[model samples]
Target: MQLWRRFTHRLRSRQAGDALLALPLGLIVVIVLADVLAARLPLGPSLLIVAPALTASFASTLVTGAIAAVAVAGMLIIGLDSHLLGTVDYGSQFFALLVVSGVVTVFCYLRERRARELALVRMVSEATQRAVLRPLPRQIGPLRVASMYLAAQEQSLMGGDLYAAIRTPTGTRLIIGDVMGKGLTAISDAALLLGAFRESAHRQADLPELAAYLDRSVCWNLAEPSEVETAGECFITAALLDIPDALPLIHMVSCGHPPPLLLRARQVSALRATKPAPPLGLGELTAAVYHVDTFAFEPEELLLLHTDGVIEARDARGAFYPLAERASSWTLHSPSALIRHLRTDLLAHVGGHLTDDAAVIAVQHTFRQTPTVVHTTDDSA
Candidate 1:
């Protein structure tokens, strides 16, 4: 039954395209009849060239060539019937139509070839992004979560922004960060930091220790000889959070990253770190010391973690997006609903385009009895 439906759908689509393709031929027939019946008028075989030129825009090279052939044949028939086949005027028209159709066919082939190459490149980039930036589960431990990533580069799937969540014996630990620059270098740095976090998040005893381990990893990884060129200025701003299942307290360490916002009972406030340290990869230069900042994270409250790209997005007038102001209205929304609203509103504020890549994760504290499985929903649109 499914096969029958699929076959019928394809048949209908092909029939529609076939009907659309006949338009150029219908045009050729009309022009030929006009030239034959009203020989005195300026209407002649000159207008037949329009058929093939029009077909090239929407049809394949084969269909375009076939239409061009039909058009040329129509011109010959008109010229022979009118006794003008051998005249210089009719000959020039024939040659012009032939040359124009050939050029259009060549262009069609080149365009399709480039399009196929572009599609292949896009597929590869998307696959690499999935492997590096795996989506966060909807439910982990005692929290409901939602995540989204928006790339600034057109047709790009990955960027400098990164995030990950790992379950520990005591609670859940999550990391969100952004590399310094854009392009391939930023993506490479982000992947490196995420990998280091996922590997050490479980082994590290505390938030400060985990943060220090990540800092050392970034610093050492970027200092290699091969990366010396960008290593001088390479750094990543990150925020790490430890949420305990039984406690209402949240432990965090900020590394020159934007502070996450807390939404509770129709109020929104930024959870700024009191003793924030320098961004990762610069710990050696700055002699940075990580500190744990505890905050009250009771059940039924939502926490919003995002890259700077979100707050930095500008409108036509160059005004930055007011994330906290806009989020105040959705304080009662669930994690998923909050993310959906934020994504829509953010895009609208930037006029459907962003100058920098953005990554967002919304977490709601909840107490569920049953064990939770990974349910990830990513908005790459």
Candidate 2:
């Protein structure tokens, strides 16, 4: 898949370069014809310099040099044909074209060098993000999961928003969080939290205990003066969940994060935390106690977890995205299909560009054996 994508990208880039080449080449033909047919006019061959100048915008140094060479040759051919080869005017024009072409070629070289450096930086950034924010599996234990992340920064694939899932002996543990700030610092914080969650989720016995461990982890990491400039201010808003393979119930701990939405029978409602705790980093300072909130997560029902960026996204009319209202229509969709629809709808709401980083996870509980008493109530959470 990666090889095919790279091949298609290179093919498209080459085709674009070929299309741009026609502009300079066509200009060269037009200038050559004009100088030949209208020799008496003031239209001098020095106009040929435009060819190399235009080529430098999109072509590499080699291609620019080739076009420069063609332009120089055109100038010489016109001078000889017009019987002005030895004339002072033709000599100065020749010198000017040579000087300009050399400068443009050097400019093209510098541009290409800078472009290569930028590409290298982008590659490194992507590698680091992949290592830190690893992709979640499509299926974990008895849950079908789908996740997506949208970075607000152009050309960036990852940001402060993060999600991860781990399989426990009897259930699946999941987490979705957002760092307080943006850029590298936020990414670092997010990575730290995800690492702690992945390492401790299985070992922790319950949702509250796991949430407490995560909060302690964040508080310790951010308290380091070397790691965080504003150590006291940094915090992480997160939602942690443990979904048992046999039980149609979800145990969640919300750390100042938005509620997850439950989709069932064409109805959409929030699974709000009964008693939300402080954000992760501030938990120790406030002596916060995390509470476990149990919700009835029946089989075949989709639960959507998203960062604040999704709900805070504003349209042209300065209105927030109606996630619940829009998602009410997609209640019957599968986890992957629900994520696909939400991504499309969210991007459209924000006019194809998000103002902040957004992360989303869709989970559907699927079990082989149906539980005896299935609870169907909006107030279960």
Clash pairs, candidate 2, are none
Index of the highest-TM-score prediction: 2
User: How do the predictions measure up, each by TM-score?
Assistant: 0.88, 0.90
Runs off by more than 4 Å, candidate 2: 1-16, 33-37, 227-229, 370-381
Q: How close to the true structure is residue 15 of candidate 1, measured as C-alpha lDDT? A: 93
**Error of model 2, residue 153, in angstroms:** 2.1
Tell me the lDDT of candidate 1: 0.91
Q: How many backbone clashes does candidate 2 have?
A: 0
Per-residue CA lDDT of model 1 for 239-274, tens digit only, reads 999999987878999999999999998899999999
Reference-based lDDT, residue 28, model 2: 83
lDDT digits (tens) for residues 245-340 of candidate 2: 988999999999999999999999899999999988897789989889999988888999999999999999999999999999999999889889
